[model samples]
Target: MAPYASDDSTTGGEVDEQRSGRRKAARYVVPVTVMGVAAATIGLVPALADSGDPDLPKITAQQLIEKIATSDVQQLSGTVKISTDLGLPDLGGLESSLMSGAAGRGEGGSSADPTAKLTELASGTHTLRVAADGPDKQKLSLLENAAEYSLVHNGKDVWGYDSKSNEVFHGTASESPKHEKGKEQQPPATPKDFAEEALKAADDTTSVTVDGTAQVAGRDAYKLLIKPKQSGTTVGAITVAVDSETGMPLKFTLTPASGGAAVVDAGFTQVSFAKPAASTFDFTPPKGAKVTEEKDAGKGAEKGFGKGFHKGFDKGEARKHAPKSEEGLGKGLGGMKTIGEGWNSIATFDTGGEGVPSGKGGGDLGGFVDSLGDKVTGKFGSGTVFSTRLVNALITDDGKVYVGMVTKDALVKAADAGK
Candidate 1:
């Protein structure tokens, strides 16, 4: 039977079997290749999309103000760690030391000075913690003494407490009835209003940008970068983590703009919307603690008129030691531009040197004028120029002679000084 014709039949069968095996292998390989490619493409798409949309929401001034007007209570609490730059005005070259003290305090350590305790508490989230940085880091040291401040708003009252000094400042609600004596009733401040005021008082000259997204307390957030319009301020750029869901602020970062120093990061680890304790708004002085009433140091008072106006200087000739450069004096006057119509031109004088004693430090010009009350009544000028003059007999830290000029002139000098 010719060996059952094995050559033709078996060879054809073998060829068919090999073709079937190849197809099976190809079926498995094709899907995996497609899946891998699809995953890679999907991953790359989000990055490309996010890159194209860099402009963050530009919150208008009016929007911010309105938010403040409507808010009732706002509270942010959390474990906070801060790294500050002493080079900035706020830190006052003591940022590192202050941070170290704060860390120690968080670990249940004690500091040598009361201010250190305040710093630790102020930077913390507890009732004792303080909110230090705003739009600019320059105001860090300025608030060092505020370690004991409490901002509380009840449904009908707003109260500010300075625990360090054992004083309570209260602002009555707008709807409250005035005393028969005709005292004007003050209205309580809402949380939204507080936030708005803080934002407004922040360094507006600079612009802020959102860098990207981040995670805070396991929630999505956006990182915002704030830059100063001018130099010499405590803050250069602040990276803030804003909650994605609520648009509320979570964390803050303070860093130098030129990239020379370490960055300071502070954040709220916990937050609650519940109304703060009623006692939070009450200010009762501690036993044996002296209570001092706070006066609204008028604009001139800020120039050095209050009781501690010359705390850093001596009594006889404090002006002899006042800051001389136009920039130094102008810093205090920068806010004059924002003052609404109520006053005329503002000026500063370097009362140091010559016949003036070095003990005569800068006095609060606002307070001095305010004491005169109606006698000094003048509507704030829209285009007021604050002038300052340095007594040539005195010299500044940099060996520069005493300098003085008005706000407008100081700005001009500051701009030209660099030239």
Candidate 2:
């Protein structure tokens, strides 16, 4: 998305407002990009084998896919464990930037690091408590040491509460134009979310098969494996553990193309098919606690962490205050588009070189960009390619970004093609 507001003709007050709005939007560039890489890393890791294999009726891959599609599961509660090993360099100041930006924007009352908590999902292991009764009432609690961050979606309200800061992020689905009148919100906090996305590659881009029977969360499950047919993608194979009884995906594992340790392994450690309590969806800000209303909270629920979770902070604020650009460069998520299909697809956008916030809170955007990846030139011009085990993000010198679970060369190629 266009990172900031730019106009050739405007008054001093308009210029000041534009600068302020741009700064807020630019702050999201790093944290969101890093989290997006992490999400892709999670989507490309290896599977965890059960201690014992379970003997169940054999099902074909197509049957398993159908089963998952026809799953009648309307309510459930579970504890999910997500672990990632992207082999990333030490974040250094970026960690502080993430925490600082989160604190600075969300009502400016929180000292706690909610953004750090979310980015942690990209590095180490995390546990989440998820409960959903149909789609309208769902809750995800990110359990931390002596702290918890929750995102709850009730009938009309969506609440994100961070216990460490005692901060409440409030939003209403009815208030967001993006939300449909009778639709349900889907949070990216579930194994099913990862599985469904993986299944989309079951077409010509990948080979799908039922590898075997396995046990997950103390229940028997069918193992559905999807392997990319093309060599350009970094993903090796995506293995999903689909519950035998109810067709729910209990676990998702992604292995890198290079093949060694699994970069991501997320699954349910405990799960119940029974409906969750109604009170689980109800939330109220505590007395004297800070509350921030998010008008566009519904915008990013469908995207990965890189694009979705960060919307809670600046998207609505920037859009409301910033002047509308007919070119759509200032429209953050709206400015993004994907090229290609399936595994090699690249998400592209323009940032207009908006200065990103520093880890010390603000300043030195170029230094932050330099710290991320090496400078390289190609047919698409010079850019930075942030490489990990499974994903590479190319930030072009002209303020364009191309990201995918593909090699650096592939990213450059995509940029050149777009040009």
| RMSD per model, one decimal | 17.2, 23.0
Best by TM-score: 2
1-419: candidate 1 lDDT, tens digit per residue: 24534333222477776876676687899899999989988998767645433344555434433333343223333333344332222333254343333222232121222222233322222222322111111001123344544543343433444555554443333333322111111111111112222244244454655577676655566665555455333234556666655665556664543456533445544444343344434444467644322224211211111111122111111122222212323442232111111111112233232221122221453333223212211122111121212111212212122222112333333323322
Tell me the RMSD of model 1 versus the true structure: 17.2
Q: After best superposition, candidate 2 residue 255: deviation in angstroms?
A: 1.2
> After aligning candidate 2 to the native by TM-score, how far in Å is the CA of 325 from where it should be?
24
What's each prediction's TM-score?
A: 0.37, 0.73
lDDT of 2: 0.67
Residue 411 shift from truth in candidate 2, angstroms: 2.0
Clash counts for the predictions, in order:
53, 6
